[model samples]
Target chain A: MDVLRPSPSGVVAAEITIAEPMVRLRGVSKVYRSLRRNGTDVEALRPLDLNIARGEFVTIVGPSGCGKSTLLSLIAGLSPYTTGEIDIGGRPVAGPYTDLGIVFQKDLLLSWRTILDNVLIQAEVRGLDRRKAAARAAELLALVGLSGFEQFLPHELSGGMRQRVAICRALLHNPPLLLMDEPFAALDAITRDQLTLDFQRFWQRDRRTVVFITHNLVEAVFLGDRVIVMTPRPGGIAEILDIDLARPRNLAVRDTPDFARYTRRIHDLFIETGIIKAE
Target chain B: MSTRTRNHADAGHPGAIEGKPAGGLDKGEAPPMRRTRRRGAGRGFRRFYSVIATIVVLLIWEGGVRLFAVPALILPAPSVVFATLWERRDLYIAFSVPTTIEIVIGFFVAAVAGILLGILVSFSSFARSTFYPMLISSQLIPKVAIAPVFVIWFGTGLESKVFIAFLIAFFPIMISTMVGLQAIETDMVKLFKSMGASSTTTFIKLRLPAALPNIFAGMKIGMTLAVVGAIVAEFVAADRGLGYYLLYANGQLDSPGVFGAIMLLTVIGVILYYLVEWSQHLFMPSALIRAADLTQATM
Candidate 1:
């Protein structure tokens, strides 16, 4: 329970020390070579500067093709950024850090594995002792409201449940940082709301540092410590809104005037950046 | 894509809804569990009809043969074939029994060899790059064309028959296992990587299990080829086994014997296929259940 409180919008006012940020991206840039143009390089991500502190839930919201996924990948050390050095906990970011967990938009559940076995996959892969981890896995499943569905397969589950399982899988290892790419985007509106709420509760409970990507303004406002709005292609941070929402947020907070203000502020920012079209 | 059961309105299943929404519109309907009992009965009915059709075909053949009265040498009736099977039970027990033994032994040996070879190739990218080409090219060279060479290499005995079967069965197993191994879903691999899984863990948990279906697919094809290979090898050089028995009968103009041996081999192949399916279902109950559910829902 000593897990750091999940700073939904970790305000600079909190006097949080930035000495050893959980993740630091300093002037990071990524460019891709276009084969059609005889391998002429195209810029995808311009220089970026950001420090993600441990236990902070930062959500990146952007229009399509803004390289939000690329940023997450760079943090996970799954890919290399061309121009700048990335550091996690004072160490330089390198290829594929085991301490960083990720969940894709797809459930990515192995059809052959049982639900319980699927959860055990992470433990088996890392050569981690599973007996202890199994208890943690069950606990995480219960936290995600999937307590009795451990025996189910991905196909057997609804879209929302599969996503919940995916979330559970990412946290099964108790990684210091988690990266999610538009996880709730694939679910129905109702399911998405449920999973979003579930994720917020889980984050509050575990306090693992999370970097989630989405285009949904409400999700960004509701879940993140800081909503980092990204511009279009060759993405750059357009605005970083600090949300001062109270703890233990539930459906009750959803109807609050403050929630509408946050949502409206994000919509206005989206219009300014030309990401959201006026109705 | 509308699955079978969900397409009930099209096939005229009972209680079909006329205004049912297109695919993905079944949100309000009960889950598939509630539908399996009814769908299973429909499947059973289809199978029953197929059996009846097969019986009718056999009866028609029996009647035609009786009306034509063709000699057994030219065309043996279904009844005559059955009679041959019953009457020569003693002879078949000796010769055909040995033949079936060789078929089973050769098939199993080939399956193991192919799978092991596939694993070896998959383990080393270099081996897959180098050996896969040769493996595939070897298939282009007709197995029937080189039956004599196989007989020479493995010798004109069970070895030759087994080698041919091994050759025939080898490619499907190798190719399928390779595909299965290569088909390791990127997400599953990434999932493991995020968990700090070692290469060994990735293979055991994701690659190996994922390849089971592909391996089974290869095994099914290998099984059919094994029978073909055994028969081909026996044709070139052999004094026993079904392949030899058929050729010997053909030479002696013992038409009943030829038909009986052919029938026995077909039966064996069918039995082998179902055995593989049954076993796959037993080992992978979840996959089977999903497949069954999919079939029912689609039906």
Candidate 2:
């Protein structure tokens, strides 16, 4: 937390330090230009200044069209920003980098390859040794409770299972930073809960820097070390709340009084920003 | 989570974690063998019906000819056609050799050229814009009208027949492969690029496999058309093919000879088409086939 000291206005305080953050953004903004309509630039995200520490799990929650995904796109180098700079491990992110892994909302599994091969895609792309990578892929898949389903096609697995396979694929190469955009948004309530718990267990096993985006307040608080609350359109960070819940969190943690207070605080912040009308 | 009860969670099945034995390996899960076995049995049953349907159609055709009292000179009965085939099997086989040779050579040449052209056009926007219109316009011209031109240029040998077959077979494969390349999900492409995959690896591992079903689809159409092209070229000018034999028999008013030649040509076409189809199963993953079938069913 020393690397990220917040000012009174809820923005990261400007300070120079010898120790660099895992991720740092300064005056970053994105304006999507519409080719069909001339002279129309849709400002997706306003200038965003933030810093994330290594091994920290930060969950961002925002309303629809509030540019939560745009932030991920900028960091993943899938799209470019209109202004400012983004750095990962002290290197400017000029383009897609090999040191990061991303999980989209859909599983995006290639139906043609077996689940094992799909997980090994990271190694194939990075030109790593196949035998060693294959061994790691098997271990990761087993860690995710997909031990016997290595040869199964994506179509043969259930939706939750497919998403788990996607997770395994994302983590196969053991990237330092993991970017997820509503990865569990498409699942049912039960599956979502199951995955959330399983993900907590997995994340605690070997801490990797994680930035997760979701719309669920409870999910944001339960999984995040700090939940970033974002305002409505032309999205910008409203506040960052540190979750005080104990580690090795499970479904029972959701019922705790501290978890309820964290979710209530985030809910109130959303209401204040008019992201959701207060009932 | 024994393999016996895994079907309940197979693909889009509701409640993926409802009934599971606790302490099952890692989590409650089973291998994919059981689902594959059941699907294999279903496919076998479907093939059985396809064979039965072909036999029933032949039976009906044989019965109809006898019941109508057709004259042998005008309309040869199926039995007479079979007898003619048996009696002069050597002549038919001799004719088949040349036709088979022409088809194999032409089909492969067309396949290689079509695939190369397809890759060139789809990968580069410049090539696509420049050549795509010409590709379409070329297909619009009637292939039959150009068969004579090939004979005049390449001469009335195996060369002309093979060239004609290549001409007929190339378009469908090119067009279908192009469509397949375009049909790949944009997200899938982005995923590969995001992983820092080189262009060559993406094309070979991602784009190629994703496009297999469509490529094979085009190959099936091209195979049938290749048969047509070789026969048409032989009909124009040739002495060793079944097409030539059919024309010669027609001139002599030997109806049974004509029917036998026609049957032989059909068998060749079916065999070629099946060969292409069998490769589809080999090259295409079963998931893609299932998705295609499900899409057809829903549509």
Candidate 3:
């Protein structure tokens, strides 16, 4: 079991003030046995321990088979951890919670619905008032800067715009915690970087906790309040770097020395294993 | 589910990259010196030309037939057919009313039955296992071969024709709808999972709404097939209706009337087809807003 030995047990010695700590995982691991290709059992995740605070932005970065997504499934309670426990808000997570909302790599907007209708889906799913949710749907469209596109169908918007609608959907129910899995990884580079700031700007407004998963180091560092770096498969935490940079971060920061230095330091940590060497 | 996302991939129009900045360029491209409706207008023009060409073809057909003095036996010109239809108004009206009644009632029944069965198969994997094979086998057995039996079973009445129409129209809707319901983005389902949506919520919002576009497609196809099926069944046995009228005209050596019968059916088919399209436009998302962008994805 790889319980991330706190980077500085002494520095964080005082009781963690963030009420509820949101989510806590202990000794969580996942094993997937393939039935089609010779029935080989693959241990997708190694035992692990981690916690996300009530209103912190954390990003998990790794390659395709590194169990990053498996870990996410465990946290989201979509998939069971083979041998461990996950707790959310001090209660052992038996299954998924209504208090959490998620977004994915594909926007997955319903074709039959307008942008307004898609956003209302979250509240409708939770059995909240549909009329009320319908209004909140409009509010969220504006929140994501998609006010006029309330009637736009999923097929009618650009890739970036569709994703913005997705973000509105995730935030519509106002879940205290948001879990995102490579939501921007599918978009073009420019769109991706811009969306990173756009999402962070929204996160800053409400101060809700966010647990995001991404493989792009620049995106990881750009969005996270605390960047949690994981090693290759059977993965465990390798670095927990707290980003202390001042906020209201925009595209202009991408070229700054501090951004470069922080990026390089994290790059060195990953490449130390020789996978991503000096180049 | 494989079905959910797969449906999205297979859908006639995927919902990304709608209208552009007037020209045919992708939105991501840099703003040009001038907004040219070159691509957009070009497509519109193509559609315009097609309508014009169709009208021109019809006009020439009518003119050539009229000027050549072709006998009504060889070819009843469009005007003669129109005149005949108007003169025999009561005969056409009586026939059309019953035919339309059978079509409407039969269509509603088939749609409801097919959708319910499809949902049942989708929700229960066990039922799918047990029934899908039989379902497929039933589709393969030609309804024409079984029309006599249906006549015996339900009589040479409206019920028999309705039954045949339902049979012919059920499969496409079933398959499309099943595929649509299953066609869901896993991430979206998982999102519901994260938000604590139960299986029902996943089905209602993520699956049902996602499936609607394809469902509409299936319905359109099913509705069209209903008309053809009803006509076929009527051919097998019936006293009234256009199908029977066609047979009567042939027996009586009324060649113009026979051809008129065929023309009447063609018109019915075209009208039914357009009705489905128009309804889709009203109930489904506004195709106009998306058409400005989707109009370009011609392969």
Best by lDDT: 2
Cα lDDT tens digits, model 2, B44-78, are 68878978997888778778878888789988877
Classified by CAPRI criteria, candidate 1 counts as acceptable
Model 2, position B142: C-alpha lDDT score? 90
Collision pairs in model 2: none
Q: How many Å off is the CA of A254 in candidate 2?
A: 2.8
Over 4 Å off in model 2, which ranges? A1-19, A277-279, B1-48, B281-299
Error of 3 at A134 (Å): 5.8
Determine the C-alpha RMSD for candidate 3 after optimal superposition of all C-alphas. Answer: 6.7
Cα error, candidate 3, residue B272 (Å): 2.5
Order of candidates by TM-score, top first? 2, 1, 3
The 10-residue segment of model 2 chain A with minimum total lDDT is A8-17
- Model 3 chain A lowest lDDT segment of ten: A1-10
| lDDT head-to-head 2 vs 3, winner | 2
Per prediction, the TM-score for chain B is 0.82, 0.83, 0.79
Candidate 3 is scored at a TM of 0.83
lDDT at A141, model 1: 78
Which has the greatest DockQ?
2
